[model samples]
Target: MVLISWYLMLPPPVFPPVKDASGDYKMNTTAPISQWIKFKTFKSEDSCKARLKKMPAFYKCIASYDTALKPAATPSTSTVSGAAGSHMQ
Candidate 1:
């Protein structure tokens, strides 16, 4: 009786949601971005970029996780560009 009552009172196990190397979690099917932005662990610049590369649209909604929380620099507007432009190649 006592053991049964104690078992019933115990709380369920709580597990931190699984996250990728960049600390981003799997996108929710029904509410993807809305749910993704709620995670607090992804408050780093690099982490945000990794997330962007994986799910760029997620960037449109959530605040930047950069050190300054500012938007990343805009990409070059050139219609034609490649790694060869700078040095590589």
Candidate 2:
């Protein structure tokens, strides 16, 4: 079996209250989600693969954020479709 480890750290920052679709102060992109980051260590390539397969939610959450802090959406349909296809698969 493969073995891997994970760690999550939230930076010490106060996030402003942001309104969601329901008009409630909830944590979303407008909040300090960037304060939260994940650090992972893999024993080997196989271990990383196993972790990704077994814990897709964790993988998705960690990979969903953009390092550049740019808007996640683009103004092009083709680019959006390509990105969507890559993520959905």
Candidate 3:
């Protein structure tokens, strides 16, 4: 059986609350969301294969966000699909 797993990190909130000089709460417009990243691990060769074969359309869905934070020069589609197809089969 093939072993497949991946960890995906999500972008943080766009705005974080801050305390102003007046002791009132306010949104920090300049606050950056890039610092706080949350991620979870997924491990399931059988489950992934089952889902892929049951619905080939899932490839398209996976490809949709594959290049989300990748560099401009990165090749997104082929790498993700190729890896999944090669492993699942």
Top TM-score prediction, candidate number:
2
* Model 3 per-residue lDDT tens digits across residues 13-72: 334656668975553323333332324344544444455554323121122134433434
- Deviation from truth (RMSD, Å), model 3: 17.3
Candidate 3 lDDT trough over 10 residues, lowest sum: 56-65
lDDT per residue for candidate 2 within 1-78, as digits (tens), equals: 533343332232235656658874543333344545444544455555556666523232233333532335448998
Residue pairs that clash (backbone atoms under 3 angstroms), model 1: none
* Model 1 local distance difference test score: 0.38
Model 2 regions more than 4 Å off: 1-36, 57-89
Over 4 Å off, model 3: 1-4, 18-38, 45-65, 73-89
In model 1, what is the error at residue 80, expressed in angstroms? 56
For 1-89, candidate 1 gives per-residue lDDT tens digits of 22210000111122455666897564443332323333333444455456556543433324433232333466775633654465554
Q: Scored by CA lDDT, what does every candidate get?
A: 0.38, 0.46, 0.42
Candidates, ranked, lDDT:
2, 3, 1
What TM-score would candidate 3 get against the native? 0.24
> In angstroms, how far off is 68's CA in candidate 3?
2.4
